[model samples]
Target chain A: MSAAPVLCFDLGGTRMRAALLAPDGTRLAAVEAPTPAREGVGAVLDGLCALALRCRDTGVAPQAAGLCAPGPLDAPGGRMLAPPTLLGWRDVPVSALLGERLGLPVLLENDANAAAVGEQLYGAGQGAGSLVFVTVSTGIGGGVIVDGHVLRGRGGLAGEIGHMKIAEHSTDCACGAQGCFEALASGTALGWRAARVMRARKDGTPPPSGRDVIEAARRGERLARRLVAEHGRWLGRGFANLLHLYAPDVLVMGGGLANGFDLLEPAIRAEIARSAMPSYRETPLLSAALGDAAGLVGMAHIVRQSLPDLGRERKLG
Target chain B: MSAAPVLCFDLGGTRMRAALLAPDGTRLAAVEAPTPAREGVGAVLDGLCALALRCRDTGVAPQAAGLCAPGPLDAPGGRMLAPPTLLGWRDVPVSALLGERLGLPVLLENDANAAAVGEQLYGAGQGAGSLVFVTVSTGIGGGVIVDGHVLRGRGGLAGEIGHMKIAEHSTDCACGAQGCFEALASGTALGWRAARVMRARKDGTPPPSGRDVIEAARRGERLARRLVAEHGRWLGRGFANLLHLYAPDVLVMGGGLANGFDLLEPAIRAEIARSAMPSYRETPLLSAALGDAAGLVGMAHIVRQSLPDLGRERKLG
Candidate 1:
């Protein structure tokens, strides 16, 4: 019998990517489009409908569809529940709407979780049973896979590692929390710090982006270097907390900031090495292999696994 | 048919409790013994052997045995790895040794992880699909349960919540790290804080125990009350971190300090309400139902789940 194919969609705050995956996890076809999130969730659904129709026109019939989105999403309900990234997406019935529009089964997952599943099945965490995937882009996001299953708590809201408090008495978090790890180590936070340092300089140099901060640090800019080191230190602090709390065998770092992981790896690792339980020091920390496409591939797997009725019954275990 | 029985032991630094639970999760008999851990792990093992004999006397044939011990213990290898409480136990093959002595399969688990499994299957988390158990006693311990499986990291060393960094610029932890949750909000830390404040009194009053601090707070002792409140606030800070990271539907608070949870609930919830992502504001913070017995029962469930050759398997999912 021929293996079933699933449609995978990775939804970012601004862009959307679609892919077709065969049962053995082959990416057969792929395409991209703008999310149009500011036009509201209804318009975003309309865009997804058009994308799904376009993918269908490429001669591959999708047995099921999978969508990965910014979370606080309710995976069980296939709903996007109040994600900060998707404007006007409060309590949106994402999977149901997509399934109805496309006339196929659909599964919804947090993008980080999808990335984690992607890493575990086809990327850095291949063959690993327990893993934690951290995406450090504009913001820090994480997904935990334990005993070969995504650890989705009630309402499918588990794996919110970015918000874990790593710094004590530091800046306030966007979530109204004081000293959240995200407020210190996220890419946005790093950029914000760099810009603030530049503005405070007596030399009156213009502020820079997070990437510019890395470049400046490499070029021996004292404040920029300090900012990067501080971010790395906090990343290490957060990683230490994660090690203590999850103890996963593999920690996979991904997303845009990871492109220059060397800038942060030393200080980040130093903090973890100095702080985590000595016995757990052996756990490997590596860079994600799939990069941006991890979410799409991960969502493909989620569709296959969650919608067994679609008939691709390969055992993940 | 009568259900097979399993022998379970909860081994603490000072106390050890043993019980026999039927496959149906009924406790046939249970007893407590002094751990004498200061004498070293050998004496503790001997005590375990004696406890096995006691279980035999109850006429409940234990097909398998499980021990809930302080971790970095190896669950798969069944070894008592270096645990803080078991100072002398280093790479001891506890399960194999006990299996040989008792003529039954044996398994080992971190006490908190065991408690989490026990709670999920038989206590407050019984009906819940996923949960995180946090126990704030002399120290803090945490366990994560997802999809009815206990998450043991690569080396069976997951769930070390107490060691997570809480304060970036605070005191050192027992694990040779700075600003761990254990260093700031554990009962041990609470006692230390109370003692430090009392020592500064001109009246030469000795520092009180953690329980005394709680009592003093109840009696409106100004300094003690303030310190206790501060401890609760710090604890709340850690809880906020846990909520943000895991997003469990229920947060089960256990251990000795949880006895005062009623008094501390408001402050802890207030902190979490203020610090956590707005979406997680509603997660329940409740006291554990099983208390010390949670460890023993959790051990039984571990044996039932992990050792299929043993007859006590049906109780586990």
Candidate 2:
């Protein structure tokens, strides 16, 4: 028989995903929904409660919920405070509200922190004593895990690696910082570079998205390849900076770039090998093993570990 | 009488310092000696033993010895694993040897790590929940502190912040990496920049050291002020990377250049203010209160915490 489940939720800008996980982190069932962000907080909360309630049908009542959303959260207060991704989200009492709605205990975690915890507990970061999980997506974000616990910096803003000024970049990032690694090498930056290349093709040529650029590069298109290479180099520089700064045992690369690991791994590895100190050169760079489910899985694991009283909660009849 | 003491020693390439510390981290009697580095391992060990033994006459058999040395240490095994600054030393079983000689246990820590520990305990970092101690001396080094513990990375090499590739640089660092923060902004780099300016001698200007340049800047030398300003800007870039990377509660600047904190702080603050995320903009950057004594005090603090049994040993008999 499968073990009792843990509730997990990941709230993104446009979507909300809820899942049930067995003791060892296997997904029992999952439910997804549009975030209803434009309709305001109450609608979003209602949607989340409905999605979580969907997981109750597997004859398993999760003891506690691990609610992960974009952050700059007041974890002690169980609130999300002004995260940019979710407009109008300020001082959200996420855990408490969800706990009352679901009639279960709740633990709130920053999405990146949850992902790192998940990787440390059940994915590529398993057995790694110290790890840093970096996701190079629409924007760069990360979780710093050391000795099996996520390091929640002073305000839980510790591992914002993408915003680090790793080099001189002419472009400005959405974060109001110029030359951030995110501005130089993130998926958004890749699309920006692709658009620059496509700008001259005024004869009804559509501007390529980040995914289109990656596909073109895979097809060996010269301009796309150049853009991808530049992205890799910038990523390599960012990786080197992370290595020197944290010197984690393993660096797990997540986000969309992980899907194209084959194309970017070489330049990233070469840059780190040649540039980081000798002691940091051997840090294994691995792809995120749990893929898109990392946040859901990680949030569950975090709730299980952090809320030990969860075991005392009722199981669904 | 003061509370029991903690024995402390800081070993450098040029000198060795040993001191006895009261429980509150106040310095009692202290002694200094040449490092005996040229005499190889045996002589160096003997010198350290003699210095530590000097503290014994205080009618106080200290709890345990905290030995600070340049590293990539095997702190668990208590050994130094070939730090570049310390020539011809490798695989030295420091803690065990010192423990055997002193008849008390020993904790061997990287110098920067020890300094960080000391600061967290009693210096500028007092009451700080998390701190990152950065030393910009002949070489750049740093120690990350979180939750009152020094972050000893996977292999005790975690806090090598100087080796970070935070910006572009033309010179090769001692660590074999080009454009490392150390290569771009450290005292050694400052000297390199100063020498280049001095080399275009239409006048018989003597090539100055890094200190000489700083002194000249203080004396209002136009060229010297420019050099210092450039160095400060690079340091600012490195600071911005660190602020984003670690997000520590306090950033303590130490080492020789810290003597000129006035010259560097504004630029560093400006850089971080302009580039770092808004959440990280207010990170408190402070001068290292313990100064040259930081390494000694930090080492002792680390030992006291790491080896609880040391408290069971002699407490100033």
Candidate 3:
């Protein structure tokens, strides 16, 4: 591996994280700030550039950079296509703008895709020829790797697992669809279910957030436990669909909800055992290893790979 | 393109079809026979070899051969792993056995994958960079093509779309799963639904086959039309899931049921319009162009591609 480092950014709806990562994936410097999404695309882009400069000023001049953001993205074109969370950011040419401002070649990837690559190369999915990585946070998202590369279908829109409809009929998803996997099983869905149950009790207890429900379950609350189990059941159903579709070498679970994976594993496993075909029943499922750092590390590697000349030049400030 | 011909075979539970196909996918000669499934593996292999010999005698000697079969296959190893349809056969090395018998290297592929490749190369999916093909016959099976190659996940079982659990709860599938896409929307499922409705009516009429239901629907029978529409709704739900997962350039529908695609297209389209994420809503839905000849033509091209040396040799018998 080259000793040269790359700047990496993980741009999310809530926060934007930047890091200066060595070629081997060590973070030499890192910084994060709340996203100015409501202020429009220009402000968010400016903030991202400022963070990149901060990481660059840490006395280790980076050669290239990689940025991972929410999709729907035109990855090859390096444009973000109106992601729900990134308000007012429609068809923004992020990669070109960032590269032009920083004077470095930058590669843009979907956040979930970057995370999948990160886990595959340095985390739980290491050595797996193909992997399916799913992150269950406020909503669900996923990425797929096949034959050591991300499976980017037409328009680089493959691996949009959250929008997959898993139920015959149920709640509508934010994407304007009914019975979507994310609609039924996301953290938001769990909170919604909890709120409905609380409302039905007539005890005047306020509705809990998704995090609160998880914490309540961790504290041995019966209702919270049942709710979590139900969430796991939906997750397992979606997981079974992924298994059938990808038959991946490994399936990695990540994101906020995965913090309580132990509590969810039994229900998830049971549902998968009931739904997946016999041949797929033995597929290994594991929690992600790199956690929050996955996107940064993954993007760093992607940039290094995309701009091989950066490693050879090794320009020092 | 090489002028040499290749032999192709599509082996199914009910029948086995063989053809001598030119490099351009023309059928120089064709033959088929009922599969002797009850006569054991050896008999089936012998029958397959006999059919190959008959095709070889058609004055156009094939350079190589490709065979497609129902899967759960170890495709790299060229072995079939106990497909439910092919009773009494487990881990049968069809490629090696056929190659040895014919003195030609034979390539084995999953039937659905072969069909998908066929459609992409020479059928409705022509010019598409990637495609998802679903064949809703006795059961619903699928194949995915990405960047012009088959998406063969681990064990070559990636295209088992039939078993994806689409319903939260429903009747059990032959594979012992409840609410599978196949269990809810397959031709067999349609027959089951028709039978239940007929029994409820008590009009002294015998139960209708899935084909009878389709024919009745085509002839404008109310009950049969409703059944077909319901089937289409289930199909659309499954199609939406596929759209979200692959976002393929095109989606091809084939198999026996595809003969009635015109009847089903309206409902399928409506459900997709309602359920699919907007980005994927415009993916072209097409009927397979080559009909039953798709597998044969596709396998011929695959054989040509896999054994490039065969084209150079110009073996004329």
Candidate 4:
């Protein structure tokens, strides 16, 4: 591994996380800011440019930088396509703009694919020959790794797990599909289930969010516990379906909802046991080790692999 | 490639087809007979021995034999584990028994996987680096080839595509799953749908079977045509799902139902166009080039690969 430090960014619609990661995989410096999603693509690019510059000012001239951002990315061209999550952002030449502003070679990767690479290299998926990483948040997204390389599919959309339909839910998904796994098992779905199953607490607290529902269940609330279990069951069903499809060596869960993994693992396992054949049932499902920072971990390698001459380019320039 | 000829068998519940294939992928001799399934394992072995002896009499001393059978197989142990399609077939030591009877080494393979290998090598999937082959017979089974090798899942059941759930259909599948692809769109399902829509022929013939239904549609029977289209729709949905999962270089359809490819291809493409990303949509859906002879084609290679020393043994013996 190169001794040179690398800049990493995990950009999402709601937030952007930037970090300077040393060769030791330690974050030397980190910063976060709300994404200027509604302010238009130009404003968002300016924000990112400023963020990268601020990190570069930390008395360290990073050799290269990597940005892990939301998809439908035109990865080969280093462009960000219009993703519904990013509002009106479309056809932004991300790497060129940021590289020009920061004076460093930059590599752009899909966020979910980056996270999978991160997990495979430095977290729960180490030593696994094949893995599928599913992140359950407001929407469920995924990344698949096969034979030690991230599977990008033909369009670099191989891990769009959220759009895979699981069952007919009472409501349709934002994807215009009925009964998507995300519409059933995402934090968004859990919040709706929690709201319907449990009334306001006697303490007169605010409305229950998905995290509140997890907390309520952790506190041994009966309806909340059952509702969480129900969520876990759906999660397990999706896992089973994926197991049948990929037969991955490991299935790792990340994102915010995975924080409640303790309450969900059993139900998930049970449903998987029920659905998957005995041969496919052995793949372990585990929580991601890197937590919130997982998305950018792969950026280091991405920069190195895609731009091996970064240091030479900078010196010559 | 060796100049050694190999014996191959494609065994099913209804029949057993055998052939001696030369080094250049040509059939030296071939024969077919009823499976003798109702006569128990002993009779089945005896019949297979007789068939092998007859083929051997044609002056082809084969290096080894390969058998492709219905699965839920203990492939490593060379045992058949009660596939629902084959009655009374449980824990049959196929390789050992057949090898002993024929006085040659034997290798066992799942029929669909073998067919996929056949297609990948000598049929529509030729030259494709990655392929997904679906066999639509009485049921839907599949084989996935990636990086030039068949993907055998954890227990060698990786390509059981028929069991994948589609949506809630009116009936349950033989696999005890509701709305399985087989339950909704297989030839068996088409037969039932055809029976429902059309009465017995005016010539006082019995209710039309699945093949009869296809024949009627080919002749432009209105209700049969509509029912066949519905089957095509479901097939398209399954194709879309597989595209998202595999993003294979080519998709090949084999088995009896693929005979109706002219009827199903349009709808399959339409659903795929609607559901798959543009890049994945480019993968061609083509009929398997080998037709009904595909199952045993891969067996020749399987025998060669698994028993590489068979030639030496034959010479020494």
Best by lDDT: 3
Q: Compared with the true structure, what per-residue lDDT tens digits does model 2 show for residues B1-317? A: 22458888898888899999887777786899988887788788899889977877777778667888887778777799887766678888888777788887787888988888878887899899899999888888899998877787687778788888866556888887777888888888888898887787546677677788888888898998889988888888888788777789999988889887887777788877777777788989898998889898877666666555554544532
Give candidate 2's error at residue B253 in angstroms: 0.7
RMSD of each: 3.8, 4.0, 3.4, 4.2
For candidate 4, the per-residue lDDT at A195 reads 69
Tell me the lDDT of model 2 at A254: 88
Separately for all candidates shown, the number of backbone clashes (residues 3 or more apart, or on different chains) is 0, 1, 0, 0
lDDT of 3 at A89: 87
Worst lDDT 10-window in candidate 2 chain B: B308-317
DockQ of each model vs. true complex: 0.70, 0.68, 0.77, 0.34
Positional deviation of B252 in candidate 1, in angstroms?
1.5
Q: Write the per-residue lDDT of candidate 3 for residues B196-252, one digit (tens) a residue.
A: 989998888888778888999999999999999998998898998898888899999
Name the runs in model 1 displaced over 4 angstroms.
A218-223, A309-317, B310-317
TM-score of 3: 0.94
- Chain B TM-score, one value per candidate, order as shown: 0.93, 0.92, 0.94, 0.93
Q: Which candidate achieves the best DockQ against the true structure?
A: 3
Per residue, candidate 4 scores C-alpha lDDT tens digits across B113-135 of 88888898889999987788998
Writing each residue's lDDT as its tens digit, candidate 1 over A205-286 gives 6666677788877888887778888888888888878877788879999977787677888888888889887877767888
Task: In angstroms, give how far residue A45 of model 3 lies from its true place.
Answer: 1.8
In candidate 2, position A299 carries an lDDT of 85
lDDT tens per residue, model 4, A1-317: 57788998888989988889887678888888999988887787788877877887889878889898887787767789877778777788888888887877777888888898889889999988788999888888888877777776555656677766555344667765566778888988899877655444445555577787888889999877898899998898788778877777889999888889999899999877766666667788999998878887877766766655665665675
TM-score of the first chain of model 2? 0.92
